[model samples]
Target chain A: MSAYEKYLRNNRLPHILCSGCGHGIIMGAITRAIEKADLDQDRTVVVSGIGCSSRLPGYMDFDTLHTTHGRALGFATGVKFAKPELNVIVIMGDGDALAIGGNHFIHACRRNINITTIILNNNVYGMTSGQFSPMTPQGHFATTAPYGNVDRNFDICELSRAAGATYVARGSAYHAVMLTDLITKAIFNPGFSVVEAISQCPTYYGRKNKQGTAVDMLNAQKENCVTVAASAKITSDQMQGKIIIGELHKSEAPEYTAVYRNIVDSLQAKEMK
Target chain B: MSPTIKLLQGNEACVEGALAAGIQFYGGYPITPSTEIAELLAEKMPRVGSAFIQMEDEIAAMAAVIGASLTGAKSMTATSGPGFSLKQENLGYAIYTEIPCVIVNVMRGGPSTGLPTSPSQSDVMQARWGTHGDHPVIALCPSSVEETFWLTIRAFNLAEKYRTAVILLLDEVVGHMRERIEIPDHVDNVLTRKKPSVGREGYRPYQPDADLIPPMASFGEGYRYHVTGLTHDETGFPTNDTEKAGILIDRLHKKIDNNLDDIVEIETQMMEDAEIMVVAYGSTARSASRAVKDARALGIKAGLFRPITIWPFPANELKQYLPQLKQVIVAEMNLGQLILEVERNVAGKAPVHGVLRGDGELITPTQILARIKEVQ
Candidate 1:
């Protein structure tokens, strides 16, 4: 009944996301962002790898591809390179993007292809039932890490920026409107763009970490995150343990498809001459 | 137009054949014997306005080919032993999803990175059962540069026709060997994936026709359908229903099995009234071809049954010659791979022998001739 509802496959409704899961909220943000960006529903593709968050594309009303685990970027890169005219949006989970798929993730950023990648960082592998992931906070409890996780978590926004993403941003599921704006901007970018959407896994991640209910987790995001603009004014001591939310990086670069196209055009021009 | 004739390596001929077959996209990694496929496509794809991408790894390369194929592009990728092993993951995905793409595995000696520059047909078994699961496969083996050219085109055609991944298995000797080949002015009967005639409304992405092949709609075609690796239904959405999964898996096998007559191709040399038959494929077949002629010249009735389509196994065709065969010799670079398949099909009708070498050397015609003489 809502305007963005048209972007969903109503027939596939009653999504498999657990009660109070933040993936639904993030999914709404994605649909809203696609609508806001005015992407032709027919010309846009939603690709995902295997995971709980990766299942989101199956419910979208667009050309959707649910590929192998950790290979969404690889598949999306092919789609973008094959048909640069089509808008390619890739959805992935923290484990799907950073753990098994880490090589593809970095290479996709390095290629600077025109793809919008939204990584739903829920801190643990919810689909596989709370296994420790690369995004799991250090010393956190997971099913696999019974005593406590010793692995250091990646700063996703920093990693994306370092990997040559032309546009990098981070938003929480609590900030649904801000997440939509960030995703929309990522869609508009002419090169590779990454938006890390911190989502809550109430059933697995929250319960395993003793983080109370999903509502409590959302409230924690509200209290722990500082806007990049606001963080600039805050002292290092004041910003401790606070995640930064907002656009973290932006720059111009020659997109992979455009560079390839130039090579093709010049070769054809030589043939003409 | 006159056909251009030039000496070309088997890998180079594969590139020419792919271009002639209307390949619009290529995603590959650099690997021995197969690297030339990526190298030449890089130079030619730009000129032809098609897409060429060197992926980070073989897995990504295979994934990209499937993605590009979903856009209705005739896409392909090439790799060798280790790379082919890495590609198995995505190859299985493509098989389950029914994406039309060509995977060229120019095999080298390997259990694990054994020999990078050496020829080995060790991957023949891997080509059939590498990906895991009871899935259908269509694989072609070429014995020379000329056969490589035509088989590469045929691989793409079969991929499109069945809406499944086709493997072009070439060994290092055949892939690297150079020979003069005629470049035809035009390639006839290049098949593309069938597009749905029905409109976007009431469209089921996996609804098969009478031939059991579902017409594909490219990503941007407004059909807005879903594709997944999980066992899916006619609507293309993942289904957990046991019956639906059975139907899906069964149909995938039947589509290729029922069309085996149209798919399987076997080349026979002096098979008529021959009491001894040599079963070979890929570069090994070249040696077997020469050995058969040598046997005939020595007043012995020896023949060769070279399976061009190695995967659907060509059992029916091989069975036809079983009534007269006293013994069967399978010669290959591997110690023993396809020989198992030969024994299975021959089913004790004839004594089967293997002239196999795994030490990075081709099985010589003399070796095959000796085996034929001993069996005779």
Candidate 2:
């Protein structure tokens, strides 16, 4: 048996993801990361909002919460604040995190709470059959954007950094091993950490854009993505249209739950006096 | 030990009740008539070693409360009309997920932001149907500061006992009105959610006991389980089976409906030997109580039936009194809301008249008495 098998609910096999879907790769990476981090299974919780990616938690062997669309971060904040000892991780899709849940995403970052958020950016809403999302690139083809998307996409790593997340990183399904390493590092971060996992929705996103099968989409990621270290050495012209797939930001901040504990301690001490 | 007495606002009383009920987490936003609840809890929660968060929005606040509750904490959130509207989606999620938490809606007038500080019971219907889907609801209305204190605790107890979201529907008047209240030193019967007794291997998260409530396992208690808003089976995993969906919804309703005897509470005064009944609740009930006494003094056969548990409508209890009542007057601050329930329960056994004011004002005893005289 594989080391990650113990982390899965084997009874829930034959997941609902379509053939060539990259969400499976991301989910596998998360399980490996949790194992590598050596997090206590009983003390870990996986929360998700409504989406194809959000369904990942239901297959995992841990305390899992499948909440309303775009509200996973808010629920996760409550879980972490109420029980600071538990490790809380949130998974969301592009539309779940950026569109309907944008306000909560930014606020969760600004609070710098100790929780790991993984956003699976498949570019389009696969569950809703290729609806254009905030993370969809300009000129992308989606069911909602048959004439081609006119709205520009957001740089998720940059947005996370701007929103005050203490740790921000980006990885793709093509870089499975490195994605696991990044997720492990994010789990160790004491403040808010966001890892954007660029995933592929082959059934919807690939077909709509004629991006070929899942393998072709993954190969494209491998060809276009540049590591931050490598990008620094390349010319600006060479970096155009290239996705940076590495740790984009790291900083120290006072974690919210730890800061809140101080207030509670002092108040209890005063009452004792 | 003697209980402490103090002059407290209704919102402050709610805070006191929550503390007495051993509430460990509070998530809320700032909105008028209900803002005091958030303010006082913010100051008191940390002092008591509890967690309190002012979330980014009302929906987040409700989400936070449900999240906290899943970890076996007594969690609550407070909001007014607009915030309550924003919270409906998550509220529906809580209902479907069967997470135990308390939601305090201190209502003001509104189809949309009609009044912020004024008193209105306009949310009586919204509290039941605000969230989409056919679901059971437990809501309590408090008429005074003391009732607010006790009812807040009762709301938490019911939420935990039944494993459902309990709504404490307070109007702006009862939420903001100042009155003398005697707070008990300790709440004697604060209930917590039942925990699973079976081993982890055999435990099913959605398996109900004879009481129709499933024992809840805390997130870190080693009974690793799944919870979702989707239709789920006994194992707590989502299912697409039609029969399982029907059973899930049926159990959710039956858990509260089958146990209404313990969940419902009503106060009746001068009810015996009366031909006219006045049905009221919340701050409006205070006026109805006075009007009933005035009518009796005028030799009119009048009485009051105040439903403290507004949801589930106390229909069975109200129906029993219909035969004795020649006329029923449903007085409220709204144009009409709960009156519909009263009329339905009355079912033409007696004529039902509404004494309602939706103009950001309280329904006065004189107005209610005048209506009673006209009906007589």
Candidate 3:
């Protein structure tokens, strides 16, 4: 078996993701990252909500939890608290993380637990057919918005940084190597970390918006993205129509479980005294 | 832990009972009538090496409780009406996954938070059918403070034994009312979910043994199994085959239905040869219990049939009372929720009359007697 195949559940193969869905590539990147991190399979948990990206965890050979729509982070918080030794990673979609699960997404960041969240942003509700998600670009047509979505899109990396995530980054399925590195770093971060992987949904969002084939969407991401290093030197006007694909933000903060553990230990010790 | 007698409120007893039942995690938001459960647990859980968290919303609270339970902890959450409504989504997830946890819903008047401080039994049907899909439910209603303590432990035990969520139904009256009781130092019957007997590699997470209960494996126990809300086979992975889905649904129901005798619990006093029976639960049973004694003193053949376990309905056990019962009085603090169930079970064997009070007041013993006299 290949190294990536070792991380996947062989019996559950032939996953249900769309033929041209970028989620498969993102899943590959995540598995490779997990392998690179050398995480113990018995001590790792992958939690996801209801969406195309959420389905990724089911295909992985871990103690995977496919929870309710938009509630993966809340569930992950409990898992991390109940047993702080286990590594918890959450895989979510644009709709799962930024739309229906926005409240939990922000709060999870604010709490800064040792969870690595990978937001697979296809910018549409791919699993439920094409619908405008919170990350959908303005003027993009969706099933719910036939006339094109007028709502502004969220810069997910900025949102995560503002919500107090200690480490925040953005990469794309187009940048598989960089995405893997970002995910690996996020997993190793002591506090809450988020890596937003801008993915493509050729069957829905791509077809609805006339974005040609799956390859065309990947090429577009390659042509439009600027690295964080280049982003710092470029002016705002010069960077229009360009997405940044690299580590966007990184900082240090106290992890939630560690702080809670300290509080519990001291209180119990004082009682023992 | 030491045995001590103390005057305690019903909500306080719930907290004590949860502690005795080995509850290790509590994730809840503070809602009126049920806030005391969270407040007390928050202050007390850490001292006993448990974790108490105040979630942002009721959905997260329910979700977090399930997550904690998945890690082999006895977890719980408490909410009232509107919060309970928010919790139903994840509650359905808990039901489908068969995650063992307890949810304490202290009843409050509602059609969207109608009365936060007022008590009502309007959520009786909601407690059974609040979530979207058809699933098995175990709900226990306690009539007194002492019973609340013991039943709370029973709720945990049933949840663990059946691998399902158990609702500890309380009302504002019983939750806030204080009563003196002797608290046990150590509860002997506290039960935990059974772990898989085989090694992690040999375990199929959803494969049931002789008792129709699958042995549970915690997340970090080297058993890297998958759990989903979708229809799944014995391997605990989602399946799309209609026949497989049908079988899965049937098995979920049968697991509780086939073992109804063990799960359904009801109490009866002066039921033999009684011409009239008052069927009540929760705090309302207190009045009905008294009314039965009062009627007996007056030479009226009245009896009290209290359902300690309300949801598996105890229909067959209730059927035994219909032969001699000429009239059945269904008394509750709502506009006839459980009465409908009584009427269905009685099936014209007797005249089932409803004595309901939905104006945020308890149905007094006097009103119950008046109903009995009217039926006569």
Off by over 4 Å in 2: none
RMSD of every prediction: 0.8, 0.8, 1.1
Predicted structure with the largest DockQ when compared to the true one: 1
Alpha-carbon lDDT, every model: 0.94, 0.94, 0.91
Q: What is model 3's interface RMSD?
A: 0.7
RMSD of 1: 0.8
Q: Model 2, range B87-195, lDDT digits (tens) per residue?
A: 9999998888889999999999887988898999999989999999999999999999999999999999999989899999999999988999999887799999999
Model 2 agreement with the true structure over A1-273: per-residue lDDT tens digits: 989989999999979999999999999999999999999999999999999999999999999999999999999998999999999999999999999999999999999999999999999998888899999999999998999999999888899999999999999999999999999999999999999999988899999999999999999999999999999999999999899998999999999999999999999999999
- Order candidates by DockQ, high to low: 1, 2, 3
* All candidates: DockQ: 0.91, 0.89, 0.85
Residue pairs with clashing backbones, model 3: none
Give the CAPRI rating of model 2. high
Q: Locate the minimum summed-lDDT window of 10 residues in model 2 chain A.
A: A123-132
- Which candidate would rank higher by TM-score, 1 or 3? 1
